[model samples]
Target chain A: MIKKVLIAEDHESVNISVEKTLEELGMTQTDYVYYCDDALARIQKGVQDDQSYDLLITDLSFIKDSRVQKISGGLELIPAVRQVQPDLRIIVFSVSCIPSTIEMLFGQSDIDGYVCKGRNDAKALKEAIETVAKNQRYFPRHLTQKIRQKNVHDFTEYDIKIITLLANGMRQKDIPAYLIEEGTKPAGLSSIEKRLNYIKETLEFTKNEQLIAFCKDMGII
Target chain B: MIKKVLIAEDHESVNISVEKTLEELGMTQTDYVYYCDDALARIQKGVQDDQSYDLLITDLSFIKDSRVQKISGGLELIPAVRQVQPDLRIIVFSVSCIPSTIEMLFGQSDIDGYVCKGRNDAKALKEAIETVAKNQRYFPRHLTQKIRQKNVHDFTEYDIKIITLLANGMRQKDIPAYLIEEGTKPAGLSSIEKRLNYIKETLEFTKNEQLIAFCKDMGII
Candidate 1:
């Protein structure tokens, strides 16, 4: 039941292709603007007329220009539109892979999906629109993996201590005593050993030194 | 065939639950490391032993030292492991809502997936693991919306000019002249009109003046 789509893309070919894709997908009421300002203007007009765009598909980078614009790029445009039209579904279809930019866009906007340009992700692009329109998140396989890898590094205080102590060659039998002295409840020796053992087993390590070496290499110690 | 899972988490209760989850999933070969150091060491050892883990799941916010390790967080550990084991399937699980940070993790590192710590996203997290195991991307629905909303303000030079001209009451016939004088390929009269028409149609504008008013209000002029 998707009716209107607003695309804010600067590249003609990308724009044309996306438009065609939408049409092919039975989204014939697609509209496009080459820049952020025009795109916003169009969306606002639609809102005023009570016919707001159902979704917004945009590119990350635009041809740079030095003039007073409401915003500078897709990064800036996302927040503005969200403020005015919080319910609008959005999809970022771009070629850039700048993580910082992508993160900023995600944090500030209410986008529904993200897709990379080029042939490899074409099938993913169509699927992104359909998924986002249906209120589901659509991130290409690798991007999601990247997000997970980043999350793993966010450790807790206890985790840090365990890693540091393990790196220092402290035996599981001795860890509880040291932790208890520091006002932490002493875990059973078997529990401590089991935890370390689990670490070894899961990471596929035969000994503790390998884990220690990795910690040191990563500067986790 | 779910294989071994390496958990680099610090919390006792959480770690236990994760272990239980693994057991429930019929994955008894689970390893739990409470610190980043231990996690890395174990992973390396496993790699050396030719028994590398099938999955490396870690918390993103682990503390190395309660006081001295305040600044060094989980994010610092990704690149280290990636260098040694580029093929490792790493997933980051955390409670951070920072879009830029999430984007950086997803975009820069060799991560496989990111899952938030909230109850609402727990199901998504489980799905994320399954997706990553299958080498697919998984962006949580809420997270994607925030990222998209953050980047809508970015605009380009050409967009500024067309918007300014439109604001000045330049007729559609005059737009091509302005564009050509600016050393830009002037879109045909119909083209210019069509672009504007699309804008108006998307925004639901009945007249050109409304679009102009919107631009001025957004500071696009």
Candidate 2:
């Protein structure tokens, strides 16, 4: 039932909440640590005692509170901990809802779950822990559509510039002039239309408003 | 002692949860609407009938359903509703916890509370509703430090470039040449030093590491 959990977060308030959450989930043997170095050490010691932790919950950004440690943030600490305990389940509990950042984390690490620590976090965290315990990854339902849109078409600066301009009430034909003035490559109306068409086709949208709205909703613009 | 409340959120699940939260807060007269236009209309009717709502809870983003409306998102709706019923209390409950976005909302509107609609949202919303009822502004405790840091030093694209470079392991002395290569203005070493010094002094940090860490923690870098 995915027992022993190690929580690596600096905030005492967050720690208390997470601990309470763990208790509710029936995972009683949870260890809390503020520093990543200490968290790693706890895992190592657990391994040595032949009682390794089943999961590790961490926050991406850690405050450098007078503690000089080898690992700085949760991102760095993940890779380091994986080297020592490759089988350890990881869930990122942080404030960043940036699609690219979440995409990067899932791309870079073997994170089992991610729950943003605001709003209905306890419920989300409970869902994440349960899902991860069943050996499945938990992507936020609210952001899955946006993240899926991300996978469908990667946005370049050129595409963003075009969309952003359109969002700002720029005429479609006038985009080429702005691109040319900005020294952007393929500074042609055909190129802009083609680029936008590619996105429309990928997203299966018939109208320009739909295209713009989709990008805006997904934070691509 | 705020009693009568109106909620404007598109998602049914979110509405249910928010309704429950309001119910728990002893607010019995809670009305839910899925569109911003309807929310505005309700407020207008409330005023005309002399049965005014005490508070309005809204989500920043609303899905464009089959209805054509003057007000689109909660942000636009806030101002429109304010014009109709200027004395109504407002609490923005959304998934956006972005510091600058919150700052802009506070700058643009007389919003009484802003609670992010994610993990711990019910609790945050309860706090927000209670706080706003007593005629107080409720800012998220976690993001307040970052927002205050924002008021202390506004970061421009140039400042972001320098800090991002430093965060990426670039040397302090090498920043000028990099900025020059990128064709950024005021790309001299002295300008870079002065900018860094200004930020450091404003944030009350003596060392570059402290400045960098503070920026990183605040998501400015």
Candidate 3:
């Protein structure tokens, strides 16, 4: 029963594609805006007129122009719009994979679904709309895990350092010297090796390279 | 139709939780291994006996131990097992959100599905198993978009400088001096401003602060 979607995205191609996908999904009452300000204005007007969007699909990285008067991006906009129309379903459609941003959208906002942009966005967007329409939350499987694995509580600075060095293709032996030079909490080479060893053990890997690969793959760098 | 499941995660808590989730999903024949070595061994033995795992759920960050003669991590073991038993259903349960690593797993390895560790992992894991068992490739929705949005080929050195400056909370007017100090590219304030503008547009944001927020949230710093 969800209809009358509002899309707030900066890219023209993506806007068209999302609009097309919604049409393909039999949602023809969709409105589009290329700027965050315009989208906000439309949402405000829609609310005042009592003809608001059932869902607001936005991109989190929309930049402001000289004519624009918005303080936040799509990530922040979700809450902003929710203040006026608390019942409006919000879905984020972007190409960003950073766990921190996704956590903010899911953890802090009133968002019902998050759909990524590009090739899979079209398919996923349809799935997200359908899922949210039923009052169910849908985060893409891989992203949901990535966002949940943030480990903001117990992560150490050294852990982040090792991850960064490994990402830059530094060998295991060379990592210690680099860490020592950085000097935040310099430890001996053996200690550095041991720390990595411990990390690998904790994560379930044998090679230091796998640790590097996992750190790099997880964006711990 | 999938029943028996093999879990190859190093963490005791995570492994136990995964096992519990599988049991909740009506899977009673769940096998757990703490190291990458044991996992590979189980798969090899299973292959020889022609009773391999219906689903191989593993975290790719396993450590290297000398006593264990098996391969190092999930990346290595995935292909190794695939060589022996091409149809083995392999799902990588990881905490990584790196574009390169995920791309490699999706491109180089024929992994049936991937799930992340943490709160969302338990739920996503069940969905991944169900989806992959149905013979469909399941890429997490947010990550699928991130991978597609990855324009690895488009970044220049100036882009890095701009990203670094933005990550450091530099204002647009102050960027020209920083660019001059860095001296990588010689250009006017307009050029530096233009580059930032381009980056902002590319990411789809409405303000420099949003750009900063985006980079910070994505762990690009």
Candidate 4:
């Protein structure tokens, strides 16, 4: 049901493909820009004219050019656009496959959707726009699975501190001593071992090393 | 000085930019194709016609379209092109920032150079082409640092095996026993402890956990 949409992508081919996809969805009133600054300008102008874009499709990494602009990338542009038009829905279309980067966009930046630029991405982009238009969140299936896997193994702050210390090369017996010196309560060797064992059991990790590696990969530590 | 070059990039804008860079370098006889099949065919035909391309600049991931082709990605195309023209200097022009993937291309695939597509990449790509033309390997400053960091700590097959076991949730104490059962030599607890200590010391890692995490990130285990 969304009529007005704006796309901010640096690559002309990708920008054209996105425009084509929007056309396929029967969206005739679409605006496209190759720079973040231009996109922001259009949004600001739209707001001033009392005609705002319903959604914003953007690529996170824009190829830097000779032009000097306040907004260098899409991450910065998102919050800037949000401030001008709080009702605008945003979807990040990027090639960044890093889980931590994607997690930050979702958790911290509060993006409505993320569609990785890859094979069949045009299809994925179409689905994302349609879903986000209905005021719903959308993430690719693989990313959803990754987010779910991360959520399934919820680690407490205390658990994270202990594992982080272990990853930093602290011996198991030395942890309690360090914890006590740092004024943490229940800093007993037995308690530390019990807590670690409980966490390992819950996560189905057989070794402390594996648990540490998992935490590091998930950016929990 | 290199006179003839061939670029294999699907995106029209990137292809144009790469051609422009070549033009800047005074290399006018540049051929470009949007498909890997066309690239390989061009190389084959070039060889047959007694005029081979001096350089092959390509991107790793090509966006798939309705047309089905055998040589879909750059990894496959590199080996194919190498078979037809062994002396053709190759440089991967891509947006991929994964160190491990780049490491594999350099270490295993034996590519001449890699120029990441990012800020000031046109300059980097020009440098890469020049360096590779002189039979020298070229990786960007950051990528070279990553490759050096990887090489600084050379892990033996035995070291990798032990770390893989540890990462798979096997305890250090249980590793010796498992090694003995698996018919691995010097499976004594003392030898295992000594090897672990040596690896940690060499890598400047304080903990066995850190060692495991490092190995995982580097794709060693």
Candidate 5:
């Protein structure tokens, strides 16, 4: 049972959110600190006091404060805390949706979960906590991609054109109309659908938006 | 004497925080809608019923829902609502700190205020509301930099290196130490300070972090 948790977010509103979510999950012994140095000190104090926290939820970037500290960002804080309390379940709460940065965190920092801060962040936080408590790693459900997918196809100019249109807010169904109007080949709806499906499989993506975001991450479009 | 207020935000926790802030400021008639369309509808309904809201606080990015909406984003909703009721005071509460986008919102959408969502957002919202009530425009104070500063300098390779180091989380004081270790010329703290201050002045940025962020936005680092 993950009862004691430490939240290392700077935003008061975000802290209120995480607190509310933790309360809903029946966990009340949660402590919060806004600074990375302060978070490290709290974790150290907790371990020394024999009241070690079970989980650590932190933001990647803490706004710069007046005081200078060696452990500046959450990236610095995570490894330092791991040295002090290796078993602490850690989840990053940040606005960064960059997959490469997130993948690096999971690999290097060994965080237990990650939840992007946004519209359904509270719901995502609840799910992340529940999932992490079950000894499984959690990633944002909507933004998750098959990063392990190495089945790369040499993307043609036409494929890039279609994906670029999709990225520019053109509806998936409306792509064929634009292509047809532009006098591009395979402008039929069925052809567009088949091509998109093939691209999705090549990238191992389950949704069009995920494919778009991946293309953005890889600078493909 | 701003009385009735409407909050358009998707996050439940953010709504609670906003509602709580409103309550603390002695406003109980504040209504919250999770969608941009719902917010516009409420405003329209209020006008017809002769009970128009005095202020509208909205997030720029609303989460996508099941039903498709004609007014997809806050940018679209603002102008549409402006046509219906030109006197309605509007405040944007968004995660975007981009100065150019905010400047455009003020110029095009005629929004009364802009508050960045972050560590001090709740406090910033309070200040923005108080300031806007006086018939003034509100921009996030900490992030404010003169966007009209047209003075351009051909930045040297050394300048980019310094700003990049700052952006990479090196404290200004520690910068000289790193530069000295690298055998870079003018590695003294005073020389670094003088150069940084000159850059800030050139960019019309009052803070080092602002200078770093501006360099990032311009792709100079």
Candidate 6:
């Protein structure tokens, strides 16, 4: 049973809804802050007083104001808060649905949960909180499937090199010449074409551009 | 001198900064609302009372809340507010930098100005407000240049057809075959290649995928 939770969301409406959702779970000892800096401060103060929060739910983006904030966004605040209290569970509550971003949060940041701020998000948040409370990770089912799909298709170094070149405006025919000049293996045009085709076929992408866009979106390149 | 202005921004910090900007301009009569529905209601009520606002500044995306709103976002609110108050100097204040979206707002929506919420956005907002007050349209210099570039290109029906097909996963080599079957003119592969080369040259793009992505971003296909 999670006792104390701190929410850092810039939107007042979202903050109110998150608080209400926490209350509905019969967990009333919730604190909220509108800025990332303020949230970090509260976490630090709580840790110093030996009254640390159990969970930290935060939004990624925050609109800049007149006051300068050292910890401007949630990405920076997560690590900052983690430094003070490594055991505190963190849940990212945001509207951003970028798969690559979500992947980074899960894989690199080691966040306990992610609840997208979409329709019926309050329900999602409740489930996320419950799961995190049990020391389990929670991610939206669709995103989980996407992460699984991404993991299954482990891109090779050659695949990444070609895709990066394509994304940087290198033509397919020109790619082999560039690769050959760089002394990369299998640098023939035929090899390049076959590799792109195979990668696209594996990804179920009909166009090379789609493959490129997907790579860019996934931050693979 | 603009007497009254209404700002519709969901973020409290942005709303405050906009208010401060207005105050700096010596225009004290400013009202702020966090919801599009509330902003529209204020505009409608003002119109009904014959004490209408001189200017309206709004952000396109709004964080959804528990309360159902008829005018959920600023895009819907723009036209609705325009219907009631056509003379209201409307300025889109947003972080969205998509050329297509901004182009539509300016070209189709007949908005008076647009100020992107980037670095020095407050200064931009002030300039936008001042320009709109003088019954002149305002857009960021970069956006204006992009609009000019788009105007210069003037994509033809054939151009759109080819780009649309490319965007839809059709290979350039296969495009002519599809075009010929569809009874399209100049359906030869040579002609298609020539047209593509010409478009790429005109757009200064090195790759067909770059051209395709650019077209998609500009909403040309």
Identify the leading candidate in terms of lDDT.
4
Instruction: Write candidate 4's Cα lDDT for B2-120 as tens digits.
Output: 88899998765466667877887889999988899999999999999999899999998786667898998897899899899988888998866557667767876788898877556
Give the per-residue lDDT of model 1 (tens digit) for B92-195: 77655555556767788858788765333335556777787678767666768866884433223455567566544455677797788777754677767766
lDDT, residue A150, candidate 6? 62
Ranking under TM-score, best-scoring first?
A: 5, 4, 6, 2, 3, 1
Docking quality class, candidate 4: acceptable
Q: Residue A90 of candidate 4: its Cα lDDT?
A: 88
**Every candidate's CA RMSD:** 28.4, 13.2, 17.6, 8.3, 16.5, 8.8
lDDT of each: 0.66, 0.77, 0.68, 0.81, 0.78, 0.80
Q: Which ranges in model 5 have alpha carbons more than 4 Å from their true place?
A: A65-69, A98-104, A134-136, A143-221, B1-3, B10-12, B26-35, B49-51, B61-72, B98-109, B131-139, B143-221
lDDT of 5 by residue, A1-221 (tens): 79999999887767877887899899999998878998999999999999999999998877665777778788789999999999899999876665656776798889999987666777888999999999999987655654444355546668878877755546667877888789999998889899989987876665564555445434354
Candidate closer to the true structure by DockQ (higher is better), 2 or 4: 4
lDDT of 2 by residue, A1-221 (tens): 69999999865446656777788889999999888899999999998899999999998876664569888888788988888888999999976565665776787787888887544676788899999999999998877887676555766667777876765556778878888898998988898899888977876665454555455444454
Provide fnat values for all models in the order shown.
Answer: 0.00, 0.00, 0.00, 0.39, 0.24, 0.20
State the displacement of the C-alpha of residue A213, model 2, in Å, after optimal TM-score superposition.
15
Docking class of 6: incorrect
Alpha-carbon shift of residue A77 in model 6 (angstroms): 15
User: Which ten contiguous residues of candidate 4 chain B have the minimum total lDDT?
Assistant: B212-221
What fraction of the genuine interface contacts, i.e. the true contacts, does candidate 5 reproduce? 0.24
lDDT over C-alpha atoms for residue A201 of model 6: 82
Question: Given the true complex, what DockQ would model 4 score?
Answer: 0.25
Candidate 6 displacement at residue A47 in angstroms = 21
lDDT of 3 by residue, A1-221 (tens): 77899988765435655676688788999998777777878999999998988988887775444455564567557777878788888888865555665665687785788765432346777788888988999788766666566453223657767655554445557766776677756557777777767776776665543444344333343
Clashing pairs in 5: none
lDDT of 6: 0.80
Arrange candidates by lDDT, highest first: which order? 4, 6, 5, 2, 3, 1
Task: Give the residue spans of candidate 2 off by over 4 A.
Answer: A4-52, A57-74, A92-108, A114-128, A137-221, B5-52, B57-72, B92-108, B114-131, B136-221
